[model samples]
Target: MLKEVYGNECSSRTQVYKWFKLFKEERETTEEDPHPGPPSTSKKEENIEEISKLIREDRRLSIRGLAEKTGIDKECVRQILHESFNMRKVCAEMMPKLLTPEQKESRMKICVDIPNNIDIS
Candidate 1:
C-alpha cells in the first residue's frame, strides 16, 4: 500500500486517480497545468508608502494595529516593517536596525546623563 510504502510523500488516492486519467488522455507531463488567477495586490509600492507614512506618524504602533488600520494581514505588516523599512521593535516602538548618527549622539548623551543624575542612597 502507498500508505505503508510512501507514508506522507504520496498524494491522496483521488489525486492519483486524476493523474492516471490525465496520463491516459496523453498528457505529456506529470506537472500541473498553469491556471490563471487574479494578481496579488497587497504588497504593492502604494502599501509600502502607506506603511512608511503610518510609521513616521507613530513609531509605537504595533503590527496588529498597522494591519487593522491598513486592512493588511498582520504577517504582511510585519514583513513590510522588517523588509521594506528595515525596522524592529524595541521598547514597544519600531526603530531602524542601524542607528543614524544623530540618534547615536542622542543616545550617548542620555547614557552619560543617566549616571550623573543617579544619587547614592
Candidate 2:
C-alpha cells in the first residue's frame, strides 16, 4: 500500500517492514542505536595541534611520514592537513591556506614576464 502510494519514493520493502515491526513494538523514534565501541580520537585537539606542529616544522613531510612520526594513520593525517588545516600539497610541499595579494601579483608578473622575456631565436 505504501509502495503504491509513494511509488519509487518509498524505501525498500525490507526497510519498511523493519520500521513497521518497530512501530508494532511501540518504538517511539526511528533513530539508530549508538555504536558499541571506543570513539575515534584521531581528530582530537591535541592530535590536531601535534599534526599542525609537525607540518609547520617540515612542510614537505609526506602523509606517510607524518603518520609514522605521529603514530596516526596516513588517511587521518591527510584529513587533518586538508580539512582541519585547509592546506593542499603543491610540488610535494604544503602551501599556505591563502596567498597574499603581493604574492598573487608577483606570480602574475612572473607569468606575464615569461612570454616577453623568452628569446625564440
Candidate 3:
C-alpha cells in the first residue's frame, strides 16, 4: 500500500517488504521474554554468590559498604543476606536438664560397657 502511495520515490520495494515482515515478527515475539514480568534489578547467581562470599568473609560490613563494593543496593545486600542466606545474629541459651537416677545409672552403665567392648550392655 505504501509502495502504491509513494510510487518510485520510496527508494526500494525489497527493503520495504523486509522491514514490514520484521515489524510483524517483532510485534508477536515481545510477549515471551524469559524474565516475563518487570526486569530484575539484582545481579545473577554468580554475582550473588560473590556477594554472599564477601558477606561471609566479613559479617560486620555494613550494607552500604557491601553495596559500594558489590555495586548493588544496600537494601538488596540486606535482602540477599536475610532472605537468600537466612542469616541472623541471635544468642541462644541451652541448659542441661537433670536426669532421673535410673536414667543416669543406665547411661553410666552403657558408657562403661561400651568402653569395655561389651555389645550386650
Candidate 4:
C-alpha cells in the first residue's frame, strides 16, 4: 500500500513510516531456536543394564568375553568392572593340607638325610 502511494516523488512520508514498521516487524518475527544447548550428558540405561546382565551371567568371564557379549571394547569392560562395579579378581587359596605327626617327622628326617656320610662325627 505504501509503495502504491509513493509515485516516484522520493519525498513520500508513507514510505518512511512503512520502512520503519517493516524493519520492526522483521526484528520481532525472527527468533532463535529454543532447543539450543549442550548434548546429552548421560549414557543410555540399556547399555548399563546390558553390562550388568553380562557380568551377572558370568562373573569369571574374561575381558574379551565380556567385550564380545556387551559389544564393548575389552578395555572398556575392565573399566566398567573397576570403576562402576568395583570388582576385583578373587585369588584361590593354595595352602597345603595340615601335616600329620608321622608325615612331619618323615619330612624332618629327609632334611637331615642330606650328607650324613660327610658329617664331622
Candidate 5:
C-alpha cells in the first residue's frame, strides 16, 4: 500500500515495518534512543585555550606531544588543532593552515622580488 501510494519515495519495507511496529506499540516519538557513552568535553573552551597556548609556546610540538602534555586524547588534540585552531603540521611543526595578512604580503613581496631581482636582460 505504501509503495502504491508513495511509489519510490516510500522507504524500504523493513523500515516501514519497523515504524509500523513502533506505532502499534504506542511509541510516542519516532526518534532513536540516545546513544550510550561518556560525554565528550575535549573541545571545550578551557581545553581549546590550553591547546592553543601549548601550540603558541612551541609551534613545533607534535600532536602526540600535545596529547601527553595536556593529558587529552591524541585524536581530540588533533581535532582541536585542525578544526578549532585551523592549524596543520608542516615540516614536523605546527603552523597556521592559512596564511595571515602579513604572511600573505611577505609571500607576495618574495614572489615579486624574484622577477625584479633577477637579470632578465
Candidate 6:
C-alpha cells in the first residue's frame, strides 16, 4: 500500500517492518532515546592544553597516570593523546606520530609539481 502511494520513494520493506515492530512495542516516535551516561567533557580545549602542559613537564606519564592526575577518564586521556596531539606509545612513553606541517607541505608540493611536469598531449 505504501509503495502504491509513494512508488520508488517509499522505505524498503525491511525498514517498514522495523518501524512496525517499534510501533507495536509502544514506541512513541522514531527519535532515538538518549544514551545513559554522564555527558562527555574530557576532550575540551582546556583539558587538552592541561594535558599538553603535563606531558611537556613529564614525558613518562602513562594514560592511567594522566587520568588520575587530571581527573579525566583514562579513555578520554588516551584519545586526547592520540587524536589531539597525534602521539602514540613507544617504550611506555608517548611519542609523536611524526607528520610535521612542513613535511606535509613538502608532500603536497610534490603532488602539485607532478601534474605540472606531466603532459597529457
lDDT of each: 0.82, 0.79, 0.62, 0.57, 0.80, 0.81
TM-score of each: 0.60, 0.56, 0.42, 0.37, 0.56, 0.51
- Tens-digit lDDT track of model 6 for 10-46: 5677666666676678665544633222235678899
lDDT tens digits by residue: candidate 2, 1-121: 8568646755666666666776678765434733222245577789899989998898899889989998777898888899988998888888767999998999899999999999999
- True-structure lDDT of candidate 6: 0.81
Sort every candidate by TM-score, greatest first.
1, 2, 5, 6, 3, 4
Model 1 global lDDT (CA atoms, 0 to 1): 0.82
Give lDDT for model 2. 0.79
- Rank candidates by lDDT, best first: 1, 6, 5, 2, 3, 4
What is the per-residue lDDT of model 1 for residues 51-111, given as tens digits with 9 covering 90 to 100? 9999999999999999999988799899988998899999999999999899999999999
lDDT of 3 by residue, 1-121 (tens): 7458545544366555555665766643244332223234564687589777886677666667778998776777767767676664333211124567987899799988886895665
Total residue pair clashes for candidate 2: 0
lDDT pick, better of 4 and 6: 6
Scored by TM-score, the top model is: 1
Q: In terms of lDDT, which candidate is stronger, 4 or 5?
A: 5
The total of clashing pairs for model 3 equals: 0
Among all windows of ten consecutive residues in candidate 5, which has the lowest summed lDDT?
30-39
lDDT of 6 at 119: 86
Model 4 local distance difference test score: 0.57
Clashing pairs in 3: none
Count clashing residue pairs in model 6. 0
